[model samples]
Target: MRARFVSATPSEPAPPPRDGRQSAAALLVARGTRRLLRRLDFASVTELPLLSGRRADIVALSAGAELLIVEVKSSVADYRADHKWRDYRAHCDQLYFAVPASMPLDIMPQDAGLIVADAYGAAILREAPRHKVAPATRRAVVTRFAQAAAHRLHALSDPDAAGAEAF
Candidate 1:
């Protein structure tokens, strides 16, 4: 599923009430990461798409212009079922996995950084090694972020946006 921005705004409606353990966990991870990244002064958009057709759970752009992609895993099954995360590296300067505190962190790949998160906030457990993205790819991702953010903002102000086609 595409990563969606969580907000109380009518344009970007919040996710439905949690119905299961996995959904609850995902909400927590996404909320926590949103808090964590903002605290670090990075502007982020959730559910941003990559050129490869995969959606990043969260895409953050730092003040220094570094791109960061976070993959949120709510359960062991969530992690195990996903192997496409590697594809995200090409679109980001750093890639990290966000999970709840109860998860077995040891199972996470040693190469990727880790974050321990709850509904209110998150802390980085490990810093992912930075591999600077190519200049062209960085430009594309940044442009996409800008467009998505703009689209969302426009939707927020447009009462008819609900029925409008996505850009």
Candidate 2:
């Protein structure tokens, strides 16, 4: 069966807090992280599906074509319960965990980068170590990113038309 994709757009009303999936706090961290990425000259898409069948919390593309994935951890329990964040490393050049300031910094892995964020903004506390992606993988990732962005934009511009297509 084909999958149906529904992403938020400026014209649509905000989904209920958490949208029955993400917690409000986690969503806030993602919001601030996206802002921070924009400031850093990176364009990002939230909840992007990776080739490995794992969905990333945020996938950002730098001007130099570097890919970074940010996993949002709202609380200690949230971080501990998740084991799939490590799998994200294969899909991007760098991996990071973004949390609110209230989260203790030390609990996060020392290897990946870190960011502390809130609803308004965010700060990168540590830079992630880069593991360059293969050229073929980079091309595939960039293509996916562009396609996702374009699909969302099309949905916003013409909801009926976009919905009619097989996504």
TM-score of each: 0.84, 0.86
Off by over 4 Å in 2: 1-19, 162-167
RMSD in angstroms, all models?
A: 6.7, 5.8
* lDDT of candidate 1 over 65-125, digit per residue (tens): 8999999999899999989999999999899999999899999998888998999899998
Residue-by-residue lDDT tens digits, candidate 2, 58-142: 9999989999999999999999999899999888999999999999999999999999999889999999999998898889889
Q: Per model, state how many residue pairs clash.
A: 1, 0
Q: Which stretches of candidate 1 lie over 4 Å from their true place?
A: 1-22, 162-167
Assess each prediction's global lDDT (C-alpha) against the native: 0.85, 0.87
Q: Score residue 157 of candidate 1 by CA lDDT.
A: 52
